[model samples]
Target chain A: SQQGEEDPQALSIQEGENATMNCSYKTSINNLQWYRQNSGRGLVHLILIRSNEREKHSGRLRVTLDTSKKSSSLLITASRAADTASYFCATGSYNQGGKLIFGQGTELSVKP
Target chain B: GAGVSQSPSNKVTEKGKDVELRCDPISGHTALYWYRQSLGQGLEFLIYFQGNSAPDKSGLPSDRFSAERTGGSVSTLTIQRTQQEDSAVYLCASNLEINTGELFFGEGSRLTVL
Candidate 1:
């Protein structure tokens, strides 16, 4: 079963602009993770936010989690054309025997 | 291996036939996972293995879908009597331990059933 649902199935933005994607999940989770996937390739782990933490950053990636609302968002600042890919949110629940449930993903296109 | 590896990057088979997809996780990683991705969709968790024992098999769509991990390093997913609906990219991922936030994924095996 899927635990997360990402909004805005597809997004297109000009290079150097910012891109933001939102994810809403059901049930409590130990952590939430974001991933990037190029066309027809494997997924690359981007950043993870623990349940106790509210916000985290890595390079141009920023993640904010609001456990109170069971929602999280990913922000990519100064997005580059190379950043064009699909982004996904995965949630971890110990009750599920350590399996990660993923969202449908948001397809992002960065145009120069 | 340097990263999680999946073989038969592309496979074409006829309906009613069986197919085997293989995955080799990073060395010493004790956890392995199998997921399916339909075109324009997110990954669907199929199964998880912890040191050759699958504690959670609820994700398996049907009895036709089965997986096994051997030596705690490599795993195989077998689909018996494959159907066209099974045509999708089968992905494998691994992590150092259970409940880890990050997972290492493979390039995935694209399967097409005709």
Candidate 2:
């Protein structure tokens, strides 16, 4: 079973526009991490936010976690055409084997 | 000196044939994982191995799928009597330990069952 579900299965916007994707999980987690996957390629780690943290930033990427709501969001500021790809949120639970459970993912397209 | 690595970047096998996929984790990484991704779909957890501890095989879709890790380093996923529906990209990832949630993924092996 999938632990997380991402909203807006697909999104399209201009290169300079900001892209936002939301994810909701079904269980308590030690942390939530986001990954990016180019077509036909392996996933790349983007950001991780621990349960105690409310917000985190890496380069142009911003992530927020609302443990009370059991949801998280990733914001890519000033997006580029190269940023077009599939974004997934993986939930890691301490009680589990630390194996990540992934969401369906959001496909973002940035038009030049 | 490098990231996780998988063999046979692409594979084409006929239905009913058995196939094996391999993964080489980064040196000293004790945790290895296998996942499957269909076209335009998120990854599905397949199995997990942590050092010498019992492998967590609960995520495996069926008994036809089995995996083994040797010396807590390299791992292999074997699918017997493959079916056309088995076509998907098999991904391998490694993490330091159970506490570190971050995973480093390798270029997956794209398997197409004919």
Candidate 3:
């Protein structure tokens, strides 16, 4: 079963703008992670926020996790044309034995 | 190797035939995963392996699907009697351990069943 669902299935923005995507899950998680995939190929890890962390940042990527709401959001500041890709949120729980259930993902297109 | 590696990046096979996809994870990584992605679709978890423990096979969609990880390093996903519905990109990923952090993914194998 899918544990996470991302909102705004698709988003288009101009370069230099900011893009925000949200994800909600069904159960408690050990951690939530964000990944970027370009051209439907390999996925690159972006950031990971543990259940105890409310927010975390790496470069221009900011991720926030709200365990109470069973939700999380990813914010990409100063979006670039190169940042155009699909972002996925994955939830990892101890009961899952290390398997991370991913969301449907948000496709972000940045126009130059 | 420096990263997770998958072989036969692309495979075109006839329906009812069996196909096997391979994955070689980053050296020493104890956790590996298999996921399937259809065109424009999110990943669907297939299976997971952790160390020498019995793999978690709950995510596998059907009896036709099975996987095995040998020596806690390499894995192979086998789809028996493939159907058109099996056509998708099979992705392999590995992590250091359970809940340790991010996963390293391979380029993935694209399978086309006709």
Chain B, TM-score, each prediction?
A: 0.98, 0.96, 0.96
Order by TM-score, highest first: 1, 2, 3
* True lDDT of residue A18, candidate 1: 98
Candidates 2 and 3, the one with greater lDDT: 2
TM-score of each: 0.99, 0.98, 0.97
Which model scores highest in DockQ? Answer: 1
Superior by DockQ: candidate 1 or candidate 2: 1
Q: By the lDDT metric, which is better: model 1 or model 2?
A: 1
What's the lDDT for residue A16 in model 3? 96
Query: Which CAPRI tier for candidate 1?
Result: high
- Tens digits of per-residue lDDT, candidate 1, A1-112, equal 5799998899999999999999999999999999999999999999999999999999999999999999999999999999999999999988778689999999999999
lDDT of 3 by residue, A1-112 (tens): 6899999999999999999999999998999999999995899999999999999989998999999999999999999999999999999998877789999999999999
TM-score of 1: 0.99
Against the hidden true structure, what lDDT does model 1 obtain?
A: 0.95
Q: Candidate 1's residue-wise lDDT over B51-93, tens digit each?
A: 9999888888899999998888889999999999999999999
> What would the per-residue lDDT of candidate 3 be over residues B4-112, giving only the tens digit for each residue?
9998899999999999999999999998999999999889998888875646888788999989888888899999999999999999999888679899999999999
Model 3 in CAPRI terms: which quality? high
